[model samples]
Target: MSTHVEGSTDLKYVSDEAFIDTGVRKVVSKGNWQQQYMSLRSFPEGDRNCYKIGVTTGTKYLIRASFFYGNYDGEGMPPTFDLYLGASLWDSVKTSSSSDFTIDPEIIHVPQKNHIHICLVKTSHGIPFISAIELRPLDNSTYQAQTGSLALLDRLDTGVSTWTR
Candidate 1:
């Protein structure tokens, strides 16, 4: 059986209430969005906070993390933080401004164990927050990384004009 954690059927996102105990949930003061992005879990206390997700070992998966500041904290200044996959540094998440829509970071990785920890580390720029996280299993043969995991640099869609999730 697959060891991955299941999300809500309608939204396909695991509830933070069930998976994480830290951070207070805050709703966006502006913009109309789906239920997932409308609210976020903000970590204001800890230096590092993580969400542990179960996945099958040796399976190739596309893990995506989304951040939307929306000035949820009432502070106009957006925060800059670091994202880590376990002990390895994934990327530094920077928000240009509080009005910025969303920043989505994606990585393709094969776990060495049965679970993976997605951690957000505070960099003192602002409070760390996350809107959504998704894990989708992929075929092991595809996206063959020569040495380490692959991080998405850019994604372009030709035809679509309007914003999409």
Candidate 2:
């Protein structure tokens, strides 16, 4: 099977500014021109994260990412992050506020230039913390998903992880 993904910087427009980013923990620099993977400001007690990213429009686009988050004082996924694509935040999974997710393998089709904008928004009692995020073109791993628990798939499930006490 073949998949279309947005790979490396072909025609990049990012910046060259790096910041301490008190909210996300690790240090990060703007991608290029107006493009960046930024962690804006912190919440309050430090329980969430936020970011801003931009892309040129009119091209078929696909991005793959893995988010690594830190833990808090038994509150949950430590620093809970709210993800926003442009101004519209995605109300998917979790509490619509906090989620620690693996790459869900999603592809976004672009219809125009300077048309797509993504914001990684976080909301918590404080600022959220993140290690690193890998956003690039989709690869073979994205198209190949292990279904129904294949022997090669290294995963385990309780089969009833949602059982109530």
Candidate 3:
């Protein structure tokens, strides 16, 4: 299930209400260009909250998680938390205090099981929250990792704009 439900014609989003029994849905105080970033799900009570996604075993997929803190809680401080792929530690989500700055962490993984769990662990620094999560299927031959999953470090878009081109 997805935390946010807005989608374009090419994509469709479903609610996470049925998949998760915790967290509160909130809208960001500041406006965002993307509709999905306007709303988020925050976990306050639980030490860890997870969203389970079903996938074909051995299929390669790109999993991305987005976090945008538009000061939704009225507090100016942005929280730092841990993100987990199943039981393994994926990465740390360090959010900027700037309302416009969005942190997106992506990973290319092939799950051995039928379901993959994307979990958010609360750190003492702040509460854990998530803006969006997306999974894109990839060809088995693409993004071949030597040993384990590949975590995205940086992505550069070098294509020229229409006017420049």
Candidate 4:
């Protein structure tokens, strides 16, 4: 399920909003996402803005974080920051030219513990902010690899022949 990090404390849902930077915005955009999005939490002022999500240990899952600037700060500038999964760096959120757009990054992994830590850290450019977070369980058969973490190389279509037979 997706969690909106405004002011929720439901354990089954996303808890621990009492300890993060808070910001409210009313953004009108062409995309439907901006409509459901009501608030955004920042990380420049806080010591550490993170969410502890409960999950089955040893289970594979996909976690995603989204950020929508929407010019909430009235500065028309999108922030650049880093997202961390547990102690490892996941991805960096970059700035967008428009406030109506959003930046979403996701990771797939098996947690070593019963809980996973999702954190947003400030960079040298701007403060970190998050619009939403999502955690989904995946079947073990999906994304099997032979060694360490696998990286995406390229995607090809087998239906279409590229070379002469």
lDDT of 4 by residue, 1-165 (tens): 344333343323342363333432244343445333446666656634677777898888877677777766677677787788878878877968574677767677888789888887887777777767767788978999664343333446779667767
Candidate 2 per-residue lDDT, tens place, 1-165, comes to 222222464534222123224342343332331122232223344332334444454333454333332122234434445554445554321221233333232334342445444344544333433333323443334434333111122335767666667
Tens-digit per-residue lDDT, 86-109, candidate 1: 989999999755464689999999
* lDDT tens digits by residue: candidate 3, 1-165: 543344554545667676567899999979655777888899998899998888899999999899999999998889999999999999999998886799999999999999999999998789999988888899999998888899998999998889973
- Alpha-carbon TM-score of each model against the true structure: 0.85, 0.39, 0.88, 0.71
Off by over 4 Å in 3: 1-9, 160-165
Model 2 segments more than 4 A misplaced: 1-24, 27-54, 70-77, 91-107, 124-126, 129-165
Which candidate would rank higher by lDDT, 1 or 2? Answer: 1
Among these predictions, the greatest TM-score belongs to 3
- Descending-TM-score candidate ranking: 3, 1, 4, 2
Alpha-carbon local distance difference test for all models: 0.85, 0.35, 0.87, 0.66
Model 1 per-residue lDDT at 31: 78
Q: Which run of 10 residues does model 1 get worst, by summed lDDT? A: 1-10
Candidate 4: residue 39 Cα off by (Å):
2.0
